[model samples]
Target chain A: MSVDVKTVKRVAHLARIAVSEDDAERMTGELNAILGFVEQLNEVDVSGVEPMTSVTPMEMKKRIDVVTDGNKAADIVANAPATDENFFLVPKVVE
Target chain B: MSDLTRLTISQARAKLHGKEITATEITEAYLSAIDRANPALNAYVAVTGDKARDMAKISDARLVKGEGGALEGIPLGIKDLFGTEGVHTQACSHVLDGFKPRYESTVTSNLWADGAVMLGKLNMDEFAMGSSNETSYYGPVINPWRRSRLDTVVMPTTHQGDGGFVSAGGTKTQRSLDNAQLVPGGSSGGSATAVSAFLCAGATATDTGGSIRQPAAFTGTVGIKPTYGRCSRWGIVAFASSLDQAGPIARDVRDAAILLKSMASVDPKDTTSVDRPVPDYEAAIGKPIKGMKVGIPKEYRVEGMPEEIEALWQKGIAWLKDAGAEIVDISLPHTKYALPAYYIVAPAEASSNLARYDGVRYGLRVPGKDIVEMYEKTRAAGFGREVKRRIMIGTYVLSAGYYDAYYLQAQKVRNLIKRDFENVFAAGVDVILTPATPSAAFGIADEDMAADPVKMYLNDIFTVTVNMAGLPGIAVPAGLDPKGLPLGLQLIGRPFEEETLFQTAAVIEQAAGTFQPEKWW
Candidate 1:
């Protein structure tokens, strides 16, 4: 299954990455080549195998619902490229 | 005392303890070495000289009081992936340009707590994505080791009767012609190069697939990627959550063991970090593996493996057998699918994790008329080519129409691959051994690998299975290839059993001896 230019453009949009016409054209070939390689997985019989999410078989550790750590808004926003006071400044999302 | 920068962690530790060398003196030696060599090697992206001195001063005070930590005053390099408080922690990507974390990563914090001084943040492949360090936005780190050249003068041929000398071969005589620049493999290439070139005593590195071990193999250093949850991944840049692990790239097996002991710890921040007691890994070194059952998987003997690697594998078998360890042949049928499955799972996780890098909160942000347009433009400009390719692949696979065929299929195949390891381990196989890489490191941006992305991904062939299975694996430099470049043998251990790997790898390291490149930088 080759990924066409239309699908490549759509995937780029879905990924929120702006792809130029030339980039989309090149991506069609690159994505297709990668897909062509990954298609080899179809040969393996994984009919009854359960999908694994964690490498170690353990439950997520649970604790009482309490605030363990926080209140360092200054630390969190220190690395923000655009910040106004304590709040991170971004392009206005609200109309 | 020939070069204080050449001291390994253990040697430096002893000297510092005995008061023969102060922490400040050793730190100055490494900083001077980095100053001299970093221009040619490009190993370090950021050198924290002031902080290193301050830390060393504190360590010196502790030594004066006759109280010091495990790695008292030892200088080391931190990989760009690990976040240092108020330091450069961009993971060598343009996306996180100028972003410095206010908090330190758990691994680095642990190392500092053990009295290890930070020399600098080392270079790496951007976001730890590429096999070679060529994908670094800061520029490819040229390895310090060049092919050894023989000192030969192409003397001009002239008869005694002739007054003037004439060249027999053309006048353009070549001296020291064999210094071809070889690549120190990635994504821990910087750590490997820094350790191999004596810029640092030991360096912190991370491995999602073969990042730690492969680079170690290429640069003739020792590295270990402990079990998935062995080290806390709290502040390290997340590549693939389940697969990513922090390890050490050091000068030898003993140094790697010492570093890993400090690096691994349970942290509340990263819930995946196990609560088990971090073992004394250094104690396991030089222990006899006399009756250990070492597994040799037939599946790793892939088609067209290099003759030297095959010979090296056989040589490893002989070394272990001679030491009274039993070698057993094993089969892992699902080995072939590990790479394909990993590409899917890693990208899927990367796409999700990288989604935070929009134009809103931090790092590089491009402006546009609308918010959506801003996100599109920011990501376009911020991410590199390989990163965008992974994002696109991830989005396509996880998209509504193709989720089952790609993402879910890959996950199920991942289970099968893990099961193959489980079966082998259940059969009482103490450890599994294979070549660290299918071949030694290739040239930076070599033509054959540059043509196709998958060709470069194939570099992880021998080491990815360990990651897929979530097992501890160590790479020990076993022999030199035909070009005199080092090749390594990988030892894979059961989950949370890094000590066994340390003990077994010592056997190979003992036989192979240590490999260091001739000084070219």
Candidate 2:
């Protein structure tokens, strides 16, 4: 299925990346081309095939709920563009 | 001293141990080379000269005590995707504006623990999204190798008669790349270009779909994508989590083995890491491949195959034959579907992995009225066009209604493709061989690639299947095309069977001999 300009806008919104009118329009054709190319996968019969859950076959290791590593509040916000007292600052949302 | 930059990693290792040369001297050689060439090559985004010397000093002290680690003082380039603690680790994207990671990636830490010196971070495609390094924000890396114009003046022109000259039957002018720049290939294009031009002894590279192998093939270097989970992924900027893997790009196959030995390890941080003993891959070189079964995948012989690449494949077969390996024709029936399925699976994972890049945590931020608008504006200003396109495609595929028809179906096709390699290997095919790329390097900002993204994706045609199968693959420079650009032959190995790939690749390197671009840059 080809994505229209509206779908492109919706996808961009879902992805949380703002697209201008020009970018959305341009992406419509670009995304359609890629989607069209990948549409060839429909020809393959995937009967009885399970979607790959992991690249390698391994059981997920369960760990006891414990603070294995911690006490690095400063390092977590070390690269944020705006931070104060090791807390990331962002645009206010709640009233 | 002038020739110090030409020495391979193995060679430099010998000199360091023998005390014939100091680590500082070699480090200086590379630093100066990078200083001279990086302006034209654009391979290295950050050259950590002082850090290289400091690390070299530590290596020299260890060598004085005869306690040097595996890589002992050898300088290497780090792909920007790797997080170097307190160093520039932007992945060549504006999204990570001025970001220096607080922690180090496990792979880079492994190299450092082995006494390898850091030459600095290399450039890459923004978030490893594109095939050509053209997608990088810093700028596309210019390949050192260029087409020789001796026999390439193909266009016919007619000139009018002048006072002293007669009308020409058909005039021809020499065509050279005086202004044309060839791409080094990507997303590890910087790593490949640096290694090929000797900007670093070897470089850390990652492969999601052909990032490592494609660039290595273009630059006449050697690169190996170890089996998935072979190298720990912790601290690396995530791309497609399942498909992304860490490897090395080096000047030759043996150097690739040497670098990989130091780069791979199982880490507690990365759960997917394989808990297998890391072998001395350098020891695997020069090993006999007598009676080994090499599979020639019939599907790899794609239509419009270049004559030179085919000839190179034939040459590789003959060399392996002479080396006592039996070439067996095999079929990977789901091969053609691998690329299309990859377009779905990679982007879907990329979309999820890249979600962590919101302005709330780190990097670039654009002010907005609300939190959501802030994220939207920040990401819009930060991510490149190709990245946005992939994220959008990924969101579309994983969105409410289209998930099963697109994402799930692609994953199933992925399983079928993986099974194709499994069935072939189960039939006693020790390793599969194919051309590394359909053609050699193309021009930077090539007009055709600008018009269609699919054309750029086709560059990874042969290399992506290896990643899909989570199998080990190596690209070894085998021959040069008539244009004088390098072409490579790929060897696909079974899971965790990197030793055989190194051994077989060593055989090819021996037969073909390694090539070097003439000093032009």
For lDDT, the strongest prediction is 2
- How many clashes does the backbone of model 2 have? 0
Write model 2 residue lDDT over B1-521, tens digit each, in one string: 45898999889999999999888999999999999999999999998999999999999999999999989989999999999999999999999899998899999999999999999999999999887899999999988888865332333355542322332544344434344679999999999999999899999999999999999999999999999989999999999999999999999988999989888997778888988899989898999999999999999999998899999999999999999999999999999999999999999999999998898788899999899999999999999999998888888999999999999999999999999999998999999999999999999889999999999999999999998889999999999988779999999999999999999999999999998887788
The lDDT, on a scale of 0 to 1, for candidate 2 is 0.92
Pairs that collide in candidate 2 are none
Q: Ten residues in a row with the worst lDDT in model 2 chain B? A: B160-169
Docking class of 2: medium
lDDT of 1 by residue, A1-95 (tens): 78889989888998999999999999898888899999999998888888888889878877779998899999888878788888988778887
lDDT of 1 at A55: 88
Residues B1-521, model 1: lDDT tens digits: 76888888999999999999999999999999999999999999999999999999999999988898999999999999999988899999888999889889999999999999999999999899888888888888877655543333444445231322335552432324255677899999899999999999999999998999999999999999999898999999998888999999999999999999999998888889988999999999889999999999999998999999999999999999999999999999999999999889889889998999896777888998888899999999998898898888888888898889999999899888889899999999999999999998788769988889999999999889888889999999999877678899999999999999999999999999998887778
> Measured against the native two-chain assembly using Cα atoms, what DockQ does each of the candidate structures obtain, in the order listed?
0.79, 0.80
Stretches off by above 4 angstroms in model 1 are B149-177
Give the clash count for model 1: 0
Predicted candidate 2 versus true structure: per-residue lDDT over A39-87, tens digit per residue: 9999999999999888788876566788899899999988888899988
